[model samples]
Target: MTSRMKPAIDIIDQRVRHAMRQVTGIEDCSAIVTPATNAKFGDYQANGAMALAKKMKTNPRKLAEQVIEKLDVSDVCQPPEIAGPGFINLRLKPEFVIESLRQMHSDPARLSIPPAEKPRKTVVDYSSPNIAKQMHVGHLRSTILGDAICRMLEFMNHKVIRQNHIGDWGTQFGKVILALWHVCMAIDVHKKSYFKNDFERLQSNKDNKNELYKICMQIRDRHDKDYINDQLEEFGDAKKYFGRFLEKLDDIIDEIWPDILLAYRFVNLLDDILPGMGLRIITREKKDNEWKPVERPYEHLTRKITVMLQQGGEENCQEEDAWHSVKKATMEHCDYIYQLLNVTLEHPRDSRGESFYKDMLAGVVEDLQKQGLAVDSDGAVCVFPEGFKNKEGDPLPFIIKKSDGAYLYATTDLAALRYRVDELKARRIIYVTDSRQKLHFDMLFAVARKAGWARDDVELSHVTFGSVLGEDGTPLKTRSGENIKLRELLDEAIGRARSVVEQKNPDLSEDQKQQIAKAVGIGAVKYADYSNNRTSDYIFSFDKMLAMDGNTAPYMQYAYARIKSIQRKAEKSGVDVEAELKDLTGIEFTQPDEIALAKYLIRYGEAVEMALADYRPNFLTNYLYELTQKFSGFYTNCPVIKAPPDSRRQRLLLCELTAGVIKHCLRELLGIEVVEQM
Candidate 1:
């Protein structure tokens, strides 16, 4: 007696393989058993005979018949049919399907899908938004996609380490630090509108380069004068006061994220206005038991700050404090988004971003150079990985370091790769990012492979996804052409769902309405993205995803709700669903709908395995959609509560299993929530 339900496909696959091996004397023969391409063929088609016959230089149909002569699937499948070109098709016996389902009902936790025979540790890198910046629509695919991959892998018993390789370090972050400094000044001594005024001026003059440059320089001057005047002694002090303020930043993160965003934007505006304009800011450095003033260029201030923060010392105390402060605020923002999206990227543990690799970057490059994989190109340290070339056919260089000593993203990525391999013991590393970064990852992976950073057996995959587009079929953006904020999009989704809920089912309580609206809204958004082929661009449509029909999340959720509602009605009308399903030994399916639903329900594991193999969630979503449709048909044909004794037990079991499968698919696997009621 098996402890868990074994999928009928697996049984048929094994039986067919045994039969083929017995006849052919090929002990290690494979039965390429897959779900039939279409229903006309059968439930599963074993195409291994064709491949074996081709390999053995024999007639395929002859080989199929020879293998079929010894095939003993009498208990599980009907007589095997050798279709065109030795395709051995096997259809499950109705009793076998019912028995397989009975086995599944014994253990509900695993849902009949056994853990992988050999599990490996996997590192899933995804959902990496920049620090001090609001998450945008661009992060939608990677976050949920990566999370789903993790869920699937973990479900398969693999040790999954989720790495949210966020853009928390680099030039943008340096600018964010500068912005935080302004926040510090504004809070401590300057007028409340000081940053506000500068930010507005910066925004207004964005198009006028000359005007923007002038304003940036003026802002820099004002900042310099303010630092000088902010003195406790005759010679003004900058670092001492700033360091103290940094220490107290944690208490104010909630109050200042909006300001942080504005300040970060201001930094971008400044960088835009003056591409390489030289300006300087004073930071405090303690030497010989004295607090002394140290100056860094305005253009390179952030870089210098980043290096110091990365390097970690008494000189970088304030910068480190500010860095941690900014990270805390940004993580809080991301947590909200994660909660809304149902992603499981936990903080502190799963999050290892670019900043985490900052210190190791130089070492990664140094090791590559030592191994002769990286070499000096012009003035930058570069690895010209083979097969990559420019439009002119020149060997493209993956620059690790600039002549000015700044580390590139390639350097940090390489560092992260090495860390994942060595420390995490990751046998497989999956990077989830936009398709635009495909080339970068290609170069990075090639360089890592050349440098012996990754083992030969290790699987390094970059799961690239396409962009989310708007109604006009362009990348999703606001009317002002700015990237749509994720938070705003979520709010709009919920608002739209509320409107829908009001129109569709207005009698529910306010709390129930809100609950349904949130589940439907967010689920719709995620399902729309999941339903898309990750490699193809998709138009994000609220009306379409939110529709309570088709292959949408709302549709799946509503179907689950309908099942639960029926179950509730069954109980209310004196039907003991649990008792009826307490024993599945005598269950019988009289209706075609029941048979179809049972067949589809058992394929859930197959869907999970397929999605995990390709990192494609659509495979799972498509399976769920089909399963729900099957359930709908079954619900219509066989009544659970009102059916005759022979049918009622079987129908109730189907309802329970359908609801379980839907919940697992939506909430557990895809990170989409479902409500009990509409």
Candidate 2:
């Protein structure tokens, strides 16, 4: 007898293309079909003909008929037919689907997603949380999204470089340093207060120190604003010239530094001078003797300011220039968070704030100016892209060089961009940041394009994402309105998972709970983050995620455990499953459920290939979930253990395949390990 088999996907594709040529009057017309959204509609559906019909100004049903007649896929599929409105439905031959499965089982990297025609280096910049300040929900989306994209691209045979563009340099460091040095009174204070401290003590210290420094900083900043307001008051008669006076003050400050410098005492100068808005520094660093000016009084002013920000200032200097001081502070409570939550990250790069970029700014500005992409606006250098608009819908510029020669995020990004493309030779650069910066990226891309740095050979993409919201649909925040810390959130998840694990399996030792809780909790959270499409927002919910039911990590994990359980039972019974597939030519799927389960068991490579094509791991997640469910159905409907010896071994082989697929899916999707037992 001649053996019957299924045609591979490529064969079907070619036959469909050939049929299109023979049946359609228009020789150039072709169709691409996708799996039907609903199984009731048939295995595959092609709406391409209807779409073409719209463009050709013809009847869609007639067009679908022509395409179906031209299609030559009789070997792999039944003849296509026009369905509702104009969709062409295709039912694949079962023999072909089954043969494809057998081939996949024998091949190593199974469903063989072809390599890129010409590969290019891709740099993924993500997980860029700032140092010192605790990571919050803001960092969660980017870190997870970036990691997922990198994982997908790598699986598809792309060279992916991972970059943790940590906020190592920035003003927040200045605040923490100044706060820690001064408010805590001594460098040793950090160790003394933080060591062995409980969460409450840490929380109290962080709140107190941040609030205290903020109030003092506020006094100076408010004083400056008041000074600006007083100037405005004096121009009441010339109200229309209000902007002119503000402009004059902006210009005068540069030329009249001494007058402004002397107006405040040295201590007050430090408070005002260090970068920050309310209670923060723009960026702070150790009081370095090398960077300080060698002139008289300027040295004394810098030192005194440093002390005021670091080791609490003498109470007598409230009148000092606010701009002359640097205050250092630490989020003392963050230590407790790390302890309670049980997660640690490498120390962030030593970036205090904007001041860290001060030197780099000059190089970036000069480059932009030389490239003719930036022009001086007022006193600052700026780059305005073509279509960006201001509040009045007038064209606005992206401020790269501040009029006072100050550098902002735009300038820093340009420097970073240059470093990425030039030093790294990254043909593709993907920035995983908040969607709120859409306009910023657009202008940045335009600037790069205009500067001739981003050519057809080099590509820049913004993988933007939506916010993580609370149960109430607002940004997830603490009760006191502070953004919840990322470390704290993760810790709570682990703790909750520990509780669940202990309740479920009380026989487990303390060490097991510790290890398993990390997996379960972290897996649940990461899976929740990833299972959703990256561009949409999802609510932060532990309870919903932890329940190992209906599309969850635990559900997939449990399915893997079930297979391991069966494997153990087979071993105990001396079933000898190893020799089962040696000559598997006569394997039979006698039960309806067995045949159905076998179908899913054999399609792992196809699911993975689909996910690789779209860069979405949710496809993998859903696939594993359904595979597990099918296995459950098979177990209930078919008696594997009591079957004839050969049949039992065949079923055991199926279980082994299930375990492998589950483990692969979890490890690839959420970076979780599968356990043989609960």
Candidate 3:
């Protein structure tokens, strides 16, 4: 199936394995073929022979020689070499390298990253932002990394289902909804920007410890009064007004969306500061089989709302209505962020938040219990998957249902895994999240395997990434130690890029400058992240990312733009680049630079294979960076426009292929936009 489009490494691996079978009479043999660790050894090195020899009790070098005796890779590679420890080094013949490029050049649509022979339904769960908070700097890595993975997988013809898995249903919603009620009351009855004033004061005094404490105390006092007075409803009082306000919530949405988010943050901050504050808020309870006022603990108020909303019924109509309204508005907020980030996540379509799996949480616990995979531990439904234990040396419980009958993330996640398998028919689920969730996912996969929800054929992976740190080696945050909003971070990046663009190319039209800045700025942020090791913490530096000299988005964009400018120059000088290469006979690797560039250019598909094999974008980025570096050497050594017709045509082919590779890696695979000018 992959005879035409299989990557170079795959082709080599197959040939080596086939030859190994002929030599050793083994039906299947591991080739362990990989790109050579160093170019001097050759283009590829087959290290599997050593392990196979150890297994069969044969000398590895002897085995390598025997395998080479029958290996039929001469059409593609030079004569294989036996190196140290029986390493069989294979270098492609120049003709094969040139032929590979010709294939990619002829079909720019694929860029040689052909569709997978056997496509699988893959679910990539990522960027699960909390509904109560704005998207922050902490969310940057997962969002972009996840997007790139989805892009790369989809490019390879995998049916990728992007699940946002947003944090929509939880006790946090209680805080936000309760806070929202105050926002409704403050404006409707008090006729004042109640939280607005306190919010401003808090922000203004965020750094002054004593002043901040005083402001917080005052705000808490007012908050207490507002929450308490709602129960003192004398027909025209706060409770009745709350009911009327909920009725009109749809109309006041636009006016309250911004303030509601701030108020929600205020509630979260207050909840953090005042621990075990047994204070209660007024809400409705079913008494005499009718809804009536009831007081609940401030801390548990969020829980009440969550339970009520999750257990949807006529009794919890108001609670459900309120949640739906807030959830809808939050979707708008997330949609705005997605648009600003150039992300492909659609609002409701891609969003399969925790709430979406609410109804299935209980059934998940029940089914696991029925299958003898889940049991009650301390009144909580738990699956004690093997290989996990607590500090007490007891098996750790993956609590699906808490003692209070409330479901945790584990329950919803299990439900999601099942849905993706049974309904979505997903053969692989790639979870993109921070490293902190590593233990959780390990337990999750273990439980799924134990329950037989995911079969042996189904792939479950936790693509964990490290934090995006500041230059100080701490998590990037605002001056007040709060999370820096993703919007502000991206806006600042674009602005910084704008200054660079205007300064470097003031002659570019204003629209063009903005377009370039947007590309450079956003591309810089994404590329900087992509260029780093995904499993290691990386410091986010605007200056470093926006710099034109380093392995950054701007650098890559500028390099691409430089090559594009050459094409423009060529056309302006009446030289058609396409025509020069359209009927070109052959490429001449005259100079060392030309040969090096050509060698790297022909390995584009190999780079794609490596990156997608392990789901690492950095490999692809590294390849593009090296390709550009090699092209720089080639551009300096080999004159395209001024050289003789033969050399000029060869250089032009390099330019065209190099440009195509960069554009594919950046725009197609990484979701990064490129510019035609710096």
The model with the greatest lDDT is: 1
Instruction: State the displacement of the C-alpha of residue 443, model 2, in Å, after optimal TM-score superposition.
Output: 1.6
Q: Which lDDT value does model 2 have at 59? A: 88
Q: If ranked by TM-score, best first, what sequence of candidates would result? A: 3, 1, 2
Report the lDDT tens digits of candidate 2 across residue range 12-94: 44555665556555566546656677767766777667766787798888877776766777766777777887987877666
Per-residue lDDT tens digits of candidate 3, residues 623-665? 9889888988887877778888888788888889899989988
Ranking by lDDT: 1, 3, 2
Off by over 4 Å in 2: 1-32, 59-62, 74-86, 107-117, 187-361, 509-511, 588-592, 601-614, 645-650
320-367 per-residue lDDT for model 1 (tens digits): 767887898888889889988879987877788898888787788788
lDDT of 3 at 61: 94
* Model 1 alpha-carbon drift over 4 Å, by segment: 14-31, 51-57, 187-192, 220-224, 227-237, 240-244, 276-301, 307-312
- With a 3 Å backbone cut-off (N, CA, C), the pairs that clash in candidate 3 are 174-302
Candidate 3 lDDT at 531 equals 94
